[model samples]
Target: MVKIKISSLSFNYDSIQALKNVSVEFREGEMVGIIGPNGAGKTTLLKCIAKLLKPHKGVIYLNGRELWSISNKELAKILAHSLFEVPKGFNLTVLDFLLTSRYPYSKGLWETEEDLAVVEEALTMVNAKHLVERKMEELSDGELQRIIMAKLIAHQAKILLVDEPTVHLDLKYQLEVLSILRRISKTKNILTVMTMHDLRLASIFSDKLVLLHEGKIIAIGKPQDVLTEENIAKTYGVKVKILKHPKAGLIVIPLSTL
Candidate 1:
């Protein structure tokens, strides 16, 4: 089902245009990676969808309803955004952090038994149940990411917008994080859209890819169709060789700058 439809979206920051006439459609059970150089408006597009930023022009529809028309509390139930940075010096336990996602639906300051059950389920879904008692400050980058995913699951949001999910991670963690995201997208039937800088990882895991350039969408489609050398060069000004991966099926290797 079409979970999101962005039509002619445009945004500006003071005198600077951040996103320009961009349009895209996302469906349930799909993971889409947004790729672009800095200033290409990838994050701006997500912020618009999350309603954190109002567009200068255009419309965003969530599950056939206008996004802006929905109340924040109602919208919170349908959409969630996972950020890149892990909070520093946070004293909350992993379970506590995940439980916060339920605040929108909470009746009071105390969490009911049902809320605890939801938190446990979300933790298990992200394979972070064992970390429930761990302090947020003690977890590694990867463990923190898993906790973030758990929070999203607890939110029970049908659509997820993640920005730079793999930032500051080693190769192994990057792979693990993307793999987890792909699984979550399918298993939970969530429409997951993330901004990523690693083109190779995006190609390997995303069901579809969106390439942005100069605040506009240069391409959007399946990985095979959108990750072409020509498109990469045009959007990133970098030359790359598209190679066949035995497992990944297709991999993009950067060759040189244009």
Candidate 2:
């Protein structure tokens, strides 16, 4: 299984410290959610893992190699990140847009049969086959999210880092997107790490949850263990009830401000 080990990772954006002495581990076939309030360094941690931001101290290892030792092209083949935004300036049809991500294997501007087949498979996996003909700019928020995911799938990366997958989406779309990520993580044996703001959804969908507050991990483990009422109150500054659901597993209910 693919393994990611982070140790004593610290980061600073000029004068403001974004992360501090953080550490965690992620394994393949598990969907881990990083949940926290604003300014909790959730995005910074992801950037550090993706090597988009250089940490000031400590190290991160993927498998056995240091994260910084991997070249950009090599990293792209193993790790891919998806942001909660649409592709700007593309304006192309969804099918054509997704084809742009296959440049790693195609190695040329021209499309090959392999590229076509892979893009088609990605479109099918993300359930966006019907939207292939639609323009990237014309899709709804939910549809755009699916297309973003399809681009990652087409990348054929083993590690997926997604930022705020459910932002700006309605309840139905939120559930749909998270379910898709969970399914693909287990079926494809990819290590999926996503940052989420919705505690209840994260608790239900994630196999593991890492709770961060002020750039440090408050708790990390199974959702039922890490998402306790005390941890929720400590990190979020809100009182909540840890409720057991017969169908949805554990759910969090916000009670009042502490």
Mark the 10 consecutive residues where model 2 has the least summed lDDT.
Answer: 83-92
Per-residue lDDT of candidate 1, residues 1-258 (tens digit): 548989999999999999999999999999999999998998989899999999989999988899999999988888899863447677767876777899888998899999999998888877788999998888988898888878887888888999888988898878877877888788889899999988888888888999999899999898889988899899889899999786865778889998
In the range 134-246, model 2's lDDT, one tens digit per residue, is 98888999999999888888988899999999999999889888888888888899999999998888988888999999999999999889988899899999999888887
Model 1 ranges off by over 4 Å: 84-90
Model 2 misplacement above 4 A: 84-90
Give per-residue lDDT, candidate 2, residue 180.
85
lDDT of 1: 0.87
Task: Superpose all Cα atoms of candidate 1 onto the true structure and report the RMSD in Å to 1 decimal.
Answer: 1.8
